[model samples]
Target chain A: MTPLPDAPAAPTAPRQPARRLRRFSRAERWVHRGTAWLMGICVFTAACLYLPPLSELVGRRRLVVTVHEWSGLMLPAPLIAGMFFRALRADLSRLNRFGRHDWHWLRTVLRKRSKEGVPAGKFNAGQKLYSAFIAGAVLVMIGTGLLMWFTHLAPVLWRTGATFVHDWLALLLAAGITGHVWMASKDPEARLGMRTGSVASWWARREHSLWKPDDKD
Target chain B: MEEPRVDDAPDDPGEENERHGAPVGRRVVLGMLGLGAAGVALGSHVQDRIDAVLAEVSAKDPTGVTGLLPGGGGFRYYSVTSSVPKRNAENYRLTVGGLVDRPMTYRLADLQAMPQQRLVHDVQCVTGWRVPKTAFSGVRLSALLAASGVRPEATAIRFDCFDGAYTESLTLQQARRSDVMVALTMQDKPVTHAHGGPVRLYAAPMYFYKSAKWLSGITLTKSVEPGYWEKLGYDVDAWVGKSNGRSDDPTS
Candidate 1:
């Protein structure tokens, strides 16, 4: 066979050390963990309060009510405190501002299409949507919870509506949280990021290629 | 002037739509509309079914679970005893004694003969349910105490239910509240056996547990005594919002 001209050398990108990237700040991790714990208590105690079988099993309605009310009331404490952290604030802002890519990402996810080439920033569309939903749901819970606790302040119609919304939204939130836990458990890197505030650079590059670290880092 | 770059930006929905060629937005809107319609229809249907089931179950439920379920307009049927002894106008007698100068007994007809005070108040339970605007008409408990000649040292009032298993108590001040009554009729009808009838104590601001059902005895006492639930760790005071370390709003 005739010898072919030597193939031109393929252009190569510069290689960098596989260092740990700051996936979350200390404040962000703390708030996430604190919110998780408080929400867990709120959900657990609520189940004990609402479900007859669970209530009977638990057998301390008064204590459960106190815990449920207080924990639900305090659900937004960490998020409120997190407002002071610049990184967390920026992250929240990013989560709130949805772009066209978010819809595309959602469609791809729903359609069960390959996620390999989908463009996503620090948080994927699902995470951003979850954050927005959870933040709003927490506010709704707090409002309705306060109304239910201070039963006489609002009219009967308002109380009834609040109770309905509170109950249904709680079930929805529980389902969402279960799905979230399942997703987190499947991804050790994501869990590690929330726990330790850092993740492998390669993992970040692969999963969230469009992500750019904050300048202060 | 700098023109906004559109080629590489991921936010260009027009470009993305061109590539995908599917009306995903329209589909989503349609899907949401369908789901919302389904939800409304299903919600109303489910609620109707639940109401029907509750009505049926409340009518016959022995454990009081159906009654305890929220959103019943009329009085719920509840009894601590497995079988409540039914008393009518002929057989029922309420005794007023203990720490009083003049102990007396009144028949059902005698109670009906007394001045009747009608109250429309919410009945709040310790378990966080409230039945609103419940109409209870009966003789004022304060009137009974006054007639019995309560002694100066009397600090509380104890109640006994004819059920023989249930008892409740209240502080004398609580007992003498204008809203407190020995309820004979509920919802404009004679109190049914299922609803602590023949006579039931109505303590408007207190939890329902303090409103002793099938009330057969009222005793003025020297000290505040804990009632059935109170003995089982419920607050003795039993005030809707103030007692039990809870801040629930008072139904009254």
Candidate 2:
């Protein structure tokens, strides 16, 4: 319309390469990996301790006890250390807060409905719930483990209850971890995100459309 | 970004009712709670029944493995010998000698007649099982040591068992704790042979190994001698939660 102004040729947008989205920061990934390894050792050593055949095969009860106790004691170390990182703290806060969307997502998943309409942000409702559960479990385990270790400090009833809870929760945790591994295996991209701290942008958009990076650069 | 809307109608009307059925959720939660309570009650009942059966089986078991199974009161019977030696109260004798000013031998009755002290303590094993609040009534070890007039140079106490092979020891200081006793009864009843009866050393704060079973001798020594399990790699000190490089909870 403005031949006179010959309208500055419509400004061309600069072309950019498609880049991977940052899913988990380096510190977050490290905390996850460290806790995962420690938890694996704890569960394995505990099995060795309780199962007669496993105990006999493993032998060296003293060594196994030491490994189990120390690994359990250190389970929370990485998470505690990661609190110093801003991104991790933010992510943790996000995980801790449950909203209507989360409830909706949980309902959809529980009913085996397509997750297509579920509104999830950086972490899905299932992931958030699992994170919260694991954090609570870690604390409970540490408390009970210490009581068991320092036998004289607590009353017999408390110790007994602690042992009961610890044992049952351990079994539950094992099952939960197995399910988590299966899910992760099914979604290789999720595993890739944890391992490499990034995921394909399209994968993130499809799986977590609500997760918009603040700075695409 | 705008927050996701929760009030939007679910894709299927039937699904909404199924998903948000509070009455169903409540019933499920209540059912789970009821099941849990029932489970606990059933567990205790089963435990009691199992204990009774185990107790009966232990009375006849020669291998002692059946006795090692955990019972209702956290008690387990562990015997190192093939069979519990037949020792009646009339036949049992406890001898205290070596480096002591007064060497004395007393029948089970004589030890039982001494001023008795009752204590409840946890019985800890090197293998990791624990029985709590086990009651033991007997003459205090300190009282016995005092009555025997321990010699100053006698730095340790050696224990010999009627089982013939098992032996244990304690330092002069350890043998004197208020909790240590030459126990004649356990759980308010006479100690059973399978449990190291007619009389056994009750080192309350130490592991069960340090509490020599089937006590037949207590000899004062110039130095500490490791016990049977101790000789075979168990901790000599065997303090609850402190020995064996394990900080187990004290069983006191």
Candidate 3:
């Protein structure tokens, strides 16, 4: 699938045409894909955790609970390990920054305007914000999760407070992640880039203007 | 959607059973509707009815009965059936059986006479609220299961509570967690009646419901049987930060 953005300007490149190189190494890609799938598993599991009548379908409540805990414990492992990669770290850092455009995008979202006209970047403001929020929230969840995991290390009060923060934030994060995934799915080019590791020049320029490769004059 | 707890969350959503009655909100509506069809619809505020119900519980045991008393550390109290009256150390008996080589019966004193463990941890309810830093003391569930000589084939352990309103089951592996205890004391002193005593299973890492208040029986089975809330709709595991309707922080 391709986007029909306005006609592309002729290339002025006097140097070799920019070709996409491996940004995320194979290990990094595996980590990313693994985590994405896991997030889905965790969220789905979390949803079932709330359903009062879930045990009959799931079987033993004890087993269901143990699965949930271990899955959660595993969720952050990939992310934390992936954070050590240079490219991933750089991407994450770039995605974390909030600038003038993000504020505008926020206003646009609040006003219920379409995203069609927005000038985007490596990650549009909303994407960046979503990434950061989820990153922070997941870390909080892991930290608090460990506290309630055992009686030592964390005091009971901390565990209680952490419980409130962990669950509420997870709800908020789940809702936000759902919306983010939905919106991102609209652009097949964006999906292609992540899946196949490349995007056509026009597609890149139209959507990720800030991240579009520099042209040779 | 991938079910996290495949054992508890069967692929089909329609077949689940919950232990804690139906969940709070929808169950009320459904219950009232079922009641109304019988021609006696109470046209009143639900809050009033809930209060009236609470009032009745308070009235039944004015001085507090066994497994109904709030402990020294400011604990919450709830009862399932109004008539189960209070029981104390002298009157309580805990039975262990089901798929086991030895079915052991213990007086409250006998259990207390076994080595005890005390833990200070957060007690999280699946609903939403939390009581923090709750101190509880009792014997480890692992020790008891071993004492009863659990069969090699045993897979799940079920808990039967004295209140009759509550029952919980744990995977044998889960029951062996070092933190899992059958609690006798909350906050330093002996757990008063309202707090699930002479003993309640204190599965610290799981949701409070999994703790199984007023615990009276333990049955080790080869497979799983849904606990009270599990029969209704709640996730069977009831672990803190994982299986509860709201996966809050972990209860370490």
Candidate 4:
């Protein structure tokens, strides 16, 4: 085989069309980042509660438990704030709204098929599933955590159940979030879209075909 | 420039089909299904009071149980999550040294050869729950200490757990309690990894914290070294109801 193209001649794609999509506005970005940090604090404090090694790591159980309580309390603050961003709110509300393509998307996901093989959009069936679970899980965690944290509104038995639900749901959430991370990490295109707000033109066509702009315009 | 809603179907099917339309009906069905899934989990949670009673009365943990309860599945059931694996009867050993006249080193077989004692009591955590009446079987730590002939100068016993993080201590008097045992077996079978297995310390009257998991080292000394938890600000003497200062019902 002949030697191929030389290094100096490599045609690099530039900021020709300024491809960055203004997908998330500043308000949406703030809400997203705030919740992300709050959730992160909760997770780390929770680790302190489970592992004996981390008891000293956080100083006291009360501190860890207190932080856990506050984290749970703060979890929905950002999402609630997101409601003010009409466009992003509309986008998320739309995600929760299932559609015809979602059935096809679900079938493709269930059958071990490639995302490339299916037509999709800004949020596929799977991303919708994540947002739905995360939203629901956070809500459950908040409500139950409050029950356990306070003594006046409920009985002792209620506290016990709340504690149980809090812990087991924590385990379940851990498992579910692992799958979430794997999906987001595996698709470089998806990762880039949220991280830097851009995607390869070809990637948009294959992964989120319905969202692709009309270039003929 | 903007994405179209997948559900933006025309009001009339007579207006045409997927040939040029969004599938609104299909979207509604799927949205209903997602809501249904969330609804199921939410409904179960909302009946929290009823569910709590049912669980407390009937729940049986799949893992081995410990502590005081109708079924022994309380939290004091010790299990290792990670360890120096592949130990066996021929290799495992327990040493009684430091302030003992006889610094005896007993192999796994040696421990089994010795006499045994069983304790049935609540396993209480410092946090204020007591799982009462869980059964534990092993030689009392005092029995082993007596057999080793602990020196009169020895005033405390320190336990080192295999977890690399858990350390616990007991006063000489507490260490000698008939209820304190370096436990060998739980629930009539070998302890599994989920509950600290092989060997562990079971101090019945105290908070479950004293029941160190993966118990490997015991040193008799003149004074107590505050335990790993104690050093980190947990009450040094972590009695079930007293330690955390909460009055929740004791867990055995």
- Which predicted model would earn the best DockQ? 4
**Residue A119 deviation, candidate 2, in Å?**
2.9
Return the DockQ of model 2: 0.03
Error of 2 at A169 (Å): 1.4
Isolated chain B TM-score per model: 0.71, 0.71, 0.69, 0.68
Instruction: Give the worst 10-residue stretch by lDDT in candidate 3 chain B.
Output: B12-21
DockQ of 4: 0.07
Q: Write the per-residue lDDT of candidate 4 for residues A169-209, one digit (tens) a residue.
A: 67777778788878878988767766664556677767766
lDDT of 3 by residue, B154-241 (tens): 9999899876667788999999999999888888888766567668789999888788877889999888788887896778877787
Instruction: State which docking tier applies to candidate 2.
Output: incorrect
TM-score of chain A of each: 0.88, 0.88, 0.77, 0.84
Model 1 chain B worst lDDT run, 10 consecutive residues: B14-23
Candidate 4 structure quality by residue, lDDT tens digits, B77-123: 22222233434566666777889888887776777777888777766
Which portions of model 1 show Cα errors greater than 4 Å? A1-18, A113-117, A215-217, B1-252
User: Which lDDT tens digits does candidate 2 get at residues A100-134?
Assistant: 55666777777876676565667667787677567
> How much DockQ does model 1 earn?
0.05
- Candidate that scores best on TM-score: 1
What is the per-residue lDDT of model 1 for residues A121-205, given as tens digits with 9 covering 90 to 100? 7777788767766766777777777866776666544555566556666777888899899989988988888889888877887
> For each candidate, what TM-score against the reference?
0.55, 0.53, 0.46, 0.54
Note the residue pairs that clash in candidate 1.
none
Candidate 2 per-residue lDDT, tens place, B17-135, comes to 22232222233334444443343334434454665787678778877666434452344344444444668878998889999889999998888789999998778776446666789
- Estimate candidate 4's alpha-carbon lDDT, on a 0 to 1 scale: 0.64
